[model samples]
Target: MTLALFDLDNTLLAGDSDHSWGEFLIHKGIVDAKAYGKANDAFFEDYKNGTLDIVAYQEFALTALIPLDSAQRKQLHNEFMAQVITPMMQPKAVKLIEKHRQQGDTLVIITATNSFVTGPIATALGIDTLLATEPEIIDSMFTGKIVGIPCFQEGKIVKLNEWLSTTGHSLDGAWFYSDSANDLPLLERVANPVAVDPDERLLKHATEQQWPVISLRD
Candidate 1:
């Protein structure tokens, strides 16, 4: 069986999943409204410029996720699915997913976005498998700590290995798609690495290596 990995933020849709999650936190009174707004804006800016590293972003997101009660977090997750996910899924991305599904590939959404937040999006997209950064929880509240490695940069590969071990799969002949320099480790480990609307560093690497490059999203 083949594995097709997708980066959840820009490559799949127009915005960052972390931003959406942060918004949900405030909308649900899980975080300070003004603080959520500021954090999301800063994160979006750095993410777009390729300056925000995944590990740091995960840490920030965990802190943001901490204030919500478990029930509130659960509700936010559901609301995000209904609002953020249902509308933001792109036609082109769906098409790509369909094409891979036709081949019976096991699809996975691997991202630095929190698994609690991104899990519903994956389910909404009909992706049953997810490899994402998970937050530690205590007494039904976010502990401001990550449970596993941050699912970015080399962490993507580590998360993938954990997923494979649990699911009995490997990276031998799988395909991975991403749009950032931080996703390089995942792109390199897979048999097929497609850079979709990659940033400068990834674009340069794709050019030097003659890797297939496409503006999957604009």
Candidate 2:
């Protein structure tokens, strides 16, 4: 069986969901305007430049939910799904997903973004398997901490291997689609690496590596 792994943010959507989710929260006044806003922007810039500290970024991203009740968080996330994330979903992305499904591959979205932000988006795309950073929760309250390794850069390979072990899946002949240089480690490991509107570094690397390059946007 072929494994088809996809990146959630810019690869499948028209925008970066992790950064946009923070902006959406700030716009809705859910997260504070000054502290969270500034940190969010800075983190996004770091991510774009492939210099992001995944652990630190996760702390910043997940902590905003610490003070919120379960019901409130759910409601706000529903709004985020509707207002912020849905419009970013592109037609070409959906079609690509469909094409992969037709190929009978076991589809999984592997993103460095936390599960809270990506779960609903994955459901919307009809993808059942998601490998994302898991936020720690206790008694329905977010602990503002991440469990296990943050699936960024080389960590993605680690996480994917662990998941595959549990499911009896092998990486042989696997495919990965991503748009970021941060995913290079996992991209290189996969048998088929497709760059989807990749960043400059990833674009150059893909060209040098002779990997297929495709665009879901445009």
How far is each candidate from the true structure, as Cα RMSD in Å?
2.5, 0.9
- TM-score, model 1 to reference: 0.86
Tens digit per residue, CA lDDT, model 2, 123-173: 999999999999999999999999999989898998999999899999899
Report the C-alpha displacement of residue 141, candidate 2, in angstroms.
0.3
lDDT against the true structure, each candidate: 0.80, 0.93
lDDT of candidate 1? 0.80
> Which candidate's lDDT is highest?
2
- How do the predictions measure up, each by TM-score? 0.86, 0.97
